[model samples]
Target chain A: MTDHLVEGVLAGDRRAIARTISLIEDNGAEAQATLAALHPHTGRAHIVGVTGPPGSGKSSLVNALALYFRRGATGERGEGGSPKTVGIIAVDPTSPFSGGAILGDRIRMRDLAGDPGIFIRSMASRGSLGGLAWATADAVKVLDAAGFELIFIETVGAGQAEVDIARTAHTTVVVEVPGLGDDVQAIKAGILEIADIFAVNKADHEGADHAVMALRMMLDLDLGGTATVLHHGRLMEVVRTVTGGEEPPSQGPLPPARPSAWRPPIFKTIATRHEGVVDLATAILAHRAYLEQSGQLVQRERERAAAELETIIQQESLRRVLACAQGEKLAALIDRIVRREIDPYTASQHLLGG
Target chain B: MTDKKIRVLIAKPGLDGHDRGAKVIARALRDAGMEVVYTGIRQTPEMIVEAALQEDVDVVGLSILSGAHMALFPRIMDLMRQHGLDDVLVVAGGIIPDEDVPALQAMGVKGVFGPGTSTDTIVRFIREHLS
Candidate 1:
């Protein structure tokens, strides 16, 4: 059965692709084996991440972008010039309080339905923070191995973890709406650092120019362009006021901080009207070409692999520790900590047999 | 390894614009610790079944207020059977009349919720039936 599944997925069988994703979501031994079988077939898809706050038209923008890519002029193919496939993974919040969520990203993407070359899956956050489920990366791998040339991962909500999906994708587009106040500064302070491209969606709205200017201003500050320090300093004062007169806490350090030779470009788009979507798609492909030419593709791959490996190691170690201390052994350790007989840090040491 | 969460798909089928009941049931199921997928309004029977198969949901709850249950529910049941969804429990809710309940049940829908039905009742039915 596993062999059949692997072969079907390799053949781009939709049912097989869907089933494999479900298995991955289960995070079981079968999923591991399936991933092992499919690993070699990955590294071919260009993973693009689009993230923004809820109601920022992220889904609509993604819908338009997917259509643009799917309908784009056929380019070089894997071998025989077969049309490219597009896969979408839209992450939606699974309310922890009720354990329920309306995964309505599909609602905004109704236009892409019934296309054999396109696949869209909506994933619930499932209590995982940072805008993605733990299984999201694995799911992307399934689509990649299934021969999707382009994959779009739309984040559930805004946060560091959500922005972290950009870490896994080749191009990360941060979508923002007009009149968001300090929210722009918050993203500018945190997630915007990873943005390879910025799309100011709902460009038909009133504050679109202000939003684009704000993003350009932030980019100028970091990109060392013709940005004047005095002007930037005044903007920072406004940022402070918007954020309650305080700078957001530093995000420590991260990639996209090393002054990459490539600078993120901003595009104004009205997603509902499909305006500027083609330009956004062209920019994404151009960025991909840039990464390839600069050999940054290999660097990003290494970074993504390192992050995935770390997460696997952390999860495995925790699982092993908990399995070793199941039932009364675990209860005893917890009770001791609750009784204040030992600190949690010391209890951790004892639990690991240190 | 023994902990597999119950997954449910709550769908509004047949051009029904009233999704308030569906949303409520979805929230209730989630509060009961089930992973619920709400396919928004106007889902066809084919779409619902495809989603059920893709999401691999253990149960499906259809919410319809457009008075199209007799036509829609049977088509959904037939499609589910065709898709080898024999093991999945099917339920219905919203404006369904008493006379239509038995017909729907005979067609393999396990439960029906009309007005005044509590979300707990629906949740408990799913737990009992699926378990």
Candidate 2:
């Protein structure tokens, strides 16, 4: 039954695709069988992960991207009917206690719901440390096997753990907005390193220029190089405010910071208005082109596959080991650790060995 | 309080970051003796469905402050149908207008809880529907 569904999905039947995804999400025997049968058909799609700060308009951007993929000025492939289908995996964080997703990504991208060329799925992190749902990789695989042209995985921006997207997605987009304070510095160390494209959304707001400059400066410093030219536009505007004159002393307190080697272009956007989305998409495509040219696309996919395989093994092994331990034995082990009869390391070794 | 757990998945679909209502409802559901799964902000329909499946939840609730509810709810319903999860009750609460209620209900959403609705009302709705 599951194999039939998989075949139907591969044949571009929306009902079949929807059913297969549902089965996979349910993790039922049928869903597992469906995935196992469909695994061979996966890996044709390009996976792109979009993440950023909480209010960085990631959803709007994703919505706009989906729209473009569905109906672009270029008369490209329509969502489902086109030669390449698109799949979206929107990842939201789940509440530890209630296990529900607070926000819905599908609602934002509602316009594209009926597009035959596109398939979108929302996933919750389920209180996972990495801010990505455990099922995200598998869902992407299902979409790939089902013959999606592009798979977009959107996640909430966690400072450090966001690097996990690098391991899953072929291209990573880190979004930022204005008025986040000096938090950009914090994001720099964690997310900036992993981003192939840097988008500054809500550019209509004040301090957008400063935010862009700050990000550019951070990128330059990380790469250990200097920006060829100081960003005179926004920086000078700030200088005008500080000095209260067109030309202030060169040694002003707001002196421009030195630049770095990798200067990721800071594109401004009013994502809600769909402004600058085309450029953003262009940048994303360009980045993918770079990856392909550099042969990093294959390498990234290989690494992601290996990592996913390892994660599955670890998770299944842990589940089995924990399930095998009875309540009394588990309690006795904890007691031994408390009494120092054996260290936690030794106890785990013994339990695993047994 | 017989403690019959109402396992609910409170999901936010799309890019809207407003979660005050989702959080409040999650708390209310928890207080109502329901094991709530709150997928914190910016979930897609796929993610919500996956959570619903993994949690083996009885009710799948969504909070969409964004106006994209029209597009989002139906897709979820379709996914639910495809997965043969039509038995799992679908409900929504957020900035939904009165006009959208019928359409949402037609899409298999058993109930629509909008603003000004009390937590007790939501709880009772779930209890009533699930029962």
- Runs of candidate 2 with Cα error greater than 4 angstroms are A73-84, A183-188, A225-263, B1-131
Error of 1 at A32 (Å): 1.3
lDDT winner: 1
Error of 1 at B54 (Å): 2.5
CA-lDDT, candidates in order: 0.78, 0.70
> Residue by residue across A198-256, what tens digits does model 1's lDDT show?
89898888999888777766754553332222210122111111111112223332233
Candidate 2 per-residue lDDT, tens place, A1-354, comes to 876887887886655665565555545667667777888888777788888887678888898887776677354655334444578887776667665444456557755644667776666565566757666777787778877888999986565556677778877788888888784573435677677677889999998988877776664443332223222011111111111111222332533532111234567888778888877776776667766775656766676667778887998788788888858888899999999999999999977997
Tens-digit lDDT string for candidate 2 (B1-131):
01123567788888899998888987787666565656677777876776565445688889998899998888888887776678898888888999989988877888888889988888888888877
Stretch of 10 with least lDDT, candidate 1 chain A: A236-245
Q: Which of the CAPRI classes, incorrect, acceptable, medium or high, describes model 2?
A: incorrect
Chain B TM, per prediction: 0.97, 0.94
TM-score of each: 0.85, 0.71
